[model samples]
Target: MAIHELAVNAVKYGALSSPEGHVTVVWHVEDRDGAQCLRIEWTETGIPVIAHAPRRSGFGTELLTQTVPYQLRGTSTLTFKPGGLQCIIELPAKGVLQ
Candidate 1:
């Protein structure tokens, strides 16, 4: 549902708001910090403006920063870029299907 939140946000204020914009999501399994992990990258481009990070945590932030990592027993990093929001998630590979 992380992607869903991002899509909803995109439709509301980011890339997906415009016909020329788009979002890219990629994932793979790899060894990280000596442990197997499912790595995912969420990138957005052509949004036309940069969205500054909110000062306080919101539902979307809570999902990306707390729920996902905690649920997967891993970690996540959410970045606000000049182009748009970028999120990197690393989930423990214990239950990830190869």
Candidate 2:
């Protein structure tokens, strides 16, 4: 549940972190191998990136992997870019949310 994680982060360490800190979540779809794949990106502008990977077990990470692919029948990949984290989840074109 990205929505849930976003909410939690907003309350804990996201937009509310400071007046200048902000987070953006976006998604789109494209055709790949005759199927539609969902590409989602999460960008945090003001948070510091102290580690290369998640420090502890967390629901956000778990949900990002499990819920998106298993539940939605998709494939997902994540990358830590220069500015923020990017996640791309690919699902069957049929029955997807968008």
Model 2, residue pairs in steric clash: none
TM-score of each model, paired residue for residue:
0.84, 0.70
* C-alpha local distance difference test of each model: 0.83, 0.64
State in Å the error of residue 7, model 2.
3.6
Off by over 4 Å in 1: none
Where does candidate 2 stray beyond 4 Å? Answer: 49-51, 78-83
Model 1, span 1-98: residue lDDT tens: 87788889889888899887889999999987798888889888887777677678778879988888678777878888776878888888878765
Q: What is candidate 2's CA lDDT for residue 44? A: 61
Give me the displacement of residue 88 in model 1, in angstroms: 0.5
Residue 71 miss distance in model 2 (angstroms): 1.2
The per-prediction tally of clashing pairs is 0, 0
lDDT (Cα, tens digit) per residue for candidate 2, span 1-98:
66577557655754446666667778788888887766766666655542355557477768877887678887666555443455555667687664
